[model samples]
Target: MLCGVHNHDLAPNLSGHLLAGRLRGEEKQRVIDMTKSLAKHRNILTDLKEKNKESVTLI
Candidate 1:
């Protein structure tokens, strides 16, 4: 579920990447653990960028 904030309240970075929304409850804990797990490993950053690039091209 989304946080449901008004669109006008949302802001993007200078590069136009929108803010990753705030997380709450048990879902937030899960994301925290998942992030730590990803960080402990290698190549996640590269893999995400590569996947995003491929997705952009496909779009």
Candidate 2:
């Protein structure tokens, strides 16, 4: 939701739909796109996490 933060992981409904395998065809493709976008976002989050850890160690 909110642009790139397709944090379906943060909500139960999206996870339920995904796990249930209820989505079909284009709907599934749409979900895949959303998940891929999230994966890209995750890479940034991981970098930020590592940077945060470094900053904490420096403190």
Candidate 3:
């Protein structure tokens, strides 16, 4: 008997994978827009964290 190792990981294109075969029409677009917004916010937060770290290191 042979078994395969399976990994449950989020796909690299998470937004597309999340929306694929799940949503359509306006709803899908809404989700995509929401993801974009969330990504923007995440980037902003990451920048802030890096800046905070730099300031802390300098002090």
Q: What TM-score would every model get versus the actual structure?
A: 0.27, 0.28, 0.27
**Candidate 1: stretches off by over 4 Å:** 1-22, 39-59
Worst lDDT run of 10 residues, candidate 3, spans 50-59
Model 1: per-residue Cα lDDT at residue 23 = 28
lDDT of 2 by residue, 1-59 (tens): 77868855655434334444343365446546756777564554454446444221110
Error of 3 at 48 (Å): 30
* Residue-wise C-alpha lDDT for candidate 3, range 1-59, written one tens digit per residue: 22664566556543334334343355346546756777564554454436444221110
The list of candidate 3 runs beyond 4 A from truth reads: 1-21, 39-59
* 10 residues in a row with least lDDT, candidate 2: 50-59
Q: For residues 25-54, what per-residue lDDT tens digits would candidate 1 score against the true structure?
A: 553465466577765323443444354443
Evaluation by lDDT, superior candidate among 1 and 3: 3
Judged by whole-model lDDT over C-alpha atoms, candidate 2 comes out at 0.46
Q: Clash totals for all models, in order?
A: 0, 0, 0
- Model 2 regions more than 4 Å off: 1-21, 39-59
State which candidate has the highest lDDT. 2
